[model samples]
Target: MNLSCGIIGKPFSGKSTLFALMTGEDGGGKFGPVRGMAKVSDSRIDYLSSLYHPKKTTYASVEFIDVPGVSGSETGENKMLEHVRNTESLLAVIGAFEEEDCDASLQGEIQGILDELLLNDLILTENRLEKIKHQRNPQEKDEFVLFSRLHEALEENRPLRSLDLKEDEQKAIKGFQFFTLKPLMFVINIHEEAIPRAEAIENRLREKLANDAHTGVIALSALIEEEIMQLPEEERPAFLEEMGIGEPATEKVIRSIYSLLGLISFFTAGEDEVKAWTIRKGASARSAAGEIHSDIERGFIKAELVHYDDFAATPDMKKLKEAGLVRLEGKEYVVRDGDIINFKFNV
Candidate 1:
């Protein structure tokens, strides 16, 4: 899956810097929007690549879009909000660095952005509710009831995702794209020294927003990430060890995203193409085939599969077959993480 995440934050929250670090894209300076794809960097792919030494390997990637900084001075436009809606997920970078005298307007600016989201959601909810109310037919009364329940929840400062909407109620609101209803991961960008306090902030957020399921918070040091990104790959571990940084911000961010978004990865390995594919945790064999190609999904017959570790140890498909580690799964079978699948599709 091409899972795209957009970075949004107030001015100087390091959204652009984080974007550059994640994407390895040079936008000249940290001003305008910057977008690029970064490899998912699966070790299984590396192992398979080494085993096969194929002509090529394809790494799964996440697209990152960095919007220009927003501050109290700037006008809160719908453009940025619209940009966020285009993505599969959102990463809101909140400034959490230490300062002698913190600017009072920072929180207000952040709230302004959030207010925009609320307003956007509010308008959508109102419009949908109005449409249901105006439907003259009594046969659609049950449908209108769904919208009414959702409308009440949205008006009461509750996101549609947060409310325990029935399956049919969820289907009712599907046409109204509510901004606040989407899953959001908040990245608190802090200074280098603040890295140690990252977990503490997450704890605090969890305590404060105990009921909010659609949102999660994580603290990251963007400046530190930028520094780490500039270092040679071989030297990174030593540098991180010296600084007591466990992992790069990029890895933490991606892992956090995977967890928050309920995403899973299944691998396809060979020298020709060793790749990791993203899917929702319970996605089926046919759905995974569709991610690779629509034709494959249309013709999907079965999936020839094995664990990455099994392939790594044996280094031969025939050996895996003999060992009984390789198995064939039908279209209804759910894709499992680390599963190395060779889709058997006629198309």
Candidate 2:
């Protein structure tokens, strides 16, 4: 599955800068949306590659669509809405670098962006309901009921994501791709001087969004991250250490997106390839096999699974099997993050 996210923010919020830092693409001057893929950095993948000595190593990635910075004009709003409607999630960048009262400013900016999204979704919901009212199909009745509940929530300034929707209900309105229903993460773009206080700023935002499960917060200096990305790969760690940053902004953002979207990774390793696969949390073994190849899932038999940590400790298939650490799981087995799986199947 393609895990796509839309990057959005008010102009001069460093939205494009963050996008460039994450994807290594400088498309700041573009009038249309810029598309790029950011690889998810995983230590587990690195270890598997080393152990398997694979000729090819692959990391899971997130496709980012950086739309033109949103402005107050209706044209800009409409353009942005058109570009991001199909994305699975959103990353809202808020400027906090130059504000004297960072907390207040951040809160205001967040609320303003959210209000706009709520209004956009409200309009769509209202229009759809109006159309449904004129339709006589039996299916329209069910759609009208579901949309009515959505409209009630949107009308009250509540995000549709806050609603506990069932699987079929989600599918019914999936095509609409309501803005407020997608997972969202707020990226607080701080200044170099604010690095020491990054934790506090993130904590404040987290507190504000404590009740919103679909939303998350992270603080990073886009300027610093851009600088870090420009350096040689071998020189990055020293620079990060000097800057007192624990992890690169790109990695943090990628991981944050995964967590916000309820995603996990499982691995398939061998001499030819060591690759990471992304799947929704609680996905079954058969479902994960399908992510690799439909034939593997179709001829499903068992998943020879071993946790990464267990393999890392033994680092020997013979020893692992002797210890009963490698076991076969059925199609219904729930795949876990960092699970090294070898699907046993015949096509």
Candidate 3:
């Protein structure tokens, strides 16, 4: 499945600017969602593109949507609650920038936003628990038990991820789609001078959120990303290196998101199309086939594969075949990262 992240923050908090940088578009405007795809910016794509020089070199992409900021309310003019509900992951941009000696109290704002999310979850959990209680003979009492635990957790200002629910218990609560339960990437928008101080901020957030699973906090200057995006593509790397930045914030955040989501990439290369496809780690060949096409999955067959590292070393598919680097796997074979595949099937 394609990964997606919803960008949200306070009004005038550079949320749209970050979205523009991520999607390479001018998405700055007043009142609507600007949505588009962003390349995952994997080095493997760059290496492959350099080698093949295809008419259209495509990298795997994730969808990014800029939703209006949360207003710290369940009912508001902005549909941020709806956006948060629909997103698989979140990128909460907290503004901490200033020119004057004004106190940028992000902790309070973040606490308020978090409180809203927790309240949303608590309300939903309570409603569901009430429903389960109404049933005299429940189909699955485990759901009630798990949800009760979750309710208690939320009551203590903890998210569902903090609980150890069974797989079935987790599935049972999936339909609720609590906002606080989703994977979160907190982006702290620091001042330009404090760009070097990001590590400290990350450490602080980490200390406070030690128990949350798959949570990441990154410090970045949105102004820096905005400036870098405006520069010519060739000049970006040198500018970033001079500024003591390794990569664009978009790349850094997206890479972290991919890791947190447990997504991996496998390739299908040819003169026709050299493409990257996202799949879950340990996904079977048949399941991956369904990502490309449902028909290909239904008509299961063997897959010709070559490990990407081995292929790069040989620099020739025919040579790899000759060297026995090529292998064929049945439907149950687990797909690995950088595996070049060709599915043979009869539908």
Best by lDDT: 2
The alpha-carbon root-mean-square deviation between model 1 and the true structure, to one decimal in Å, is: 3.3
Ranking by TM-score: 2, 3, 1
Where is model 2 more than 4 Å wrong at Cα? 99-101
lDDT of 1 by residue, 60-171 (tens): 7778877776664666546665666767677878776775313343344444555667777878767766776767787567777766776677678776668776776666
Q: Candidates 1 and 2: which is better by TM-score?
A: 2
Candidate 3 TM-score, C-alpha based:
0.89
Evaluated at residue 128, the lDDT of candidate 2 is: 92
Candidate 2 structure quality by residue, lDDT tens digits, 1-347: 79999998878889998888888887455578898899999999999898889999999999998987867654667677688889999999888778595687788888888888899999999999998887879999989999999999998889999999999999998998989988999999998999888888899888988878999899999999989878999999999999899989779998899788999999989999999999999999999999999999999999999999999999999999999999999999999998999999989
Displacement of residue 88 (Cα, Å) in model 1 is 1.6
Clashing pairs in 3: none
Model 3: per-residue Cα lDDT over 188-299, one tens digit each: 8878998776787788777766777767888888898889988999999999998888788878987887777778999887666678899999999999998899999999
Clashes of each: 1, 0, 0
TM-score for each model: 0.86, 0.97, 0.89
**Predicted structure 2, TM vs. truth:** 0.97
